[model samples]
Target chain A: MPFFKITLIRSSIGLPKKTQGVLNALGLRKRMATVFKPVNPSTAGQIMKIKELVAVSEVEAAMTSAEMKALRKPDPGYYIETPGLG
Target chain B: MFGPFRATSPLSGGLLWKIPWRLSSPQKRRQRKRLRLVDNVVATVDAALKRQNMESGRNLVRWKEEMPTEEEMRPKDKYTMFDRKEKKYRKGIHKLPKWTRVSQRINPPGF
Candidate 1:
């Protein structure tokens, strides 16, 4: 099944109440927040409501919450290595 | 009068004995022992290598520079999409500030 990845690129602060509600329903509270929903009439309506503020792309598989968080997190380089043995 | 600077040694005969000076902690003492062993091994290897190099009249510095310089290693014709795009944008927009006539030329209406 196709999954639509909706990312809020712009803020919907001054937009209509219904547009903000659509964004809130999709779990996008702040800018750059991404939410994946299955391609359906309900999701299409939400995307249409906030079309100007979001960038949508369809993907084959949906990523879990942990996987999505890991993708956005940067790696903390450097591990302590003892000379001989710690 | 003696010099202002004095070398303080941990094993000073009478002066050190009078004061309550403790040796390094157990962990620090073990670390010092390991460091001394490594230093001794390095000195021995360095001495042997120095003797060999002296016989051949070649210094260690020459071997260190075996790799080419950065300018030589990197290709002159190397191009990145980001750099090219940035240069094109800069040329097209010039030094004029954004939301100006030049910016309008580069980024037309609704772009």
Candidate 2:
């Protein structure tokens, strides 16, 4: 099954109550928060409710929260060049 | 920012603080892009759901026919919203509160 990759692009601050509720329901508490939902009527309907607040894309696989976090983590400036001889 | 009427005193008046009535060119460009993005999302979801239904042998036609395709929507639906209080019973979409995050695509049938 495909998944809808949703990223909150716009802030929901001062928006209607229901709009805030929808974003929270989608697990988006801050801007740029990304969540993957299976493509179904329920998810589609939810997206419809907050369509303007997010950027949506369809992907074949859903990444775990940890994976998403890792993607955003910066790399260290240096890596261990030499380990003890085997 | 000045007062809404530029002068709070009852006897005093000047240029009123006015919100631009029309969207600027950049605003219009971004608005159209936003509209198109939403349309793209809807189409993606519809196509995926249709594929899922086909795989499951569930021939549900309601959702398939319900979502309006991008080309099927009129410019009025994309740009203006029906507002009884505004002149001509319509208003620029940017006039809507939280418009950047709110979808106001469909209007009343006769509007």
TM-score of 1: 0.38
Against the native complex, each candidate's DockQ, computed on alpha carbons, is 0.01, 0.45
Cα lDDT tens digits for candidate 2, B25-46: 8887787787778777666666
lDDT tens digits, residue span A1-86, model 1: 66777777778766668878888899999988888886654555555455546767667788887999898888878788779874
Residue B34's lDDT within candidate 1 is 35
lDDT of 1 by residue, B1-111 (tens): 245555546344445543222223563344334333333322332343344343211222332234222233222111111123453432221122321111011122332
Candidate 2 overall lDDT versus native: 0.76
Q: Residue B85 lDDT in model 2? A: 92
Relative to the true structure, candidate 1 has a C-alpha RMSD (angstroms) of: 29.8
Docking class of 1: incorrect
Candidate 1 Cα lDDT to native: 0.48
Error of 1 at A73 (Å): 3.8
Best by TM-score: 2
Per-model TM against the reference: 0.38, 0.73
Q: What is the lDDT of residue B71 in candidate 1?
A: 31
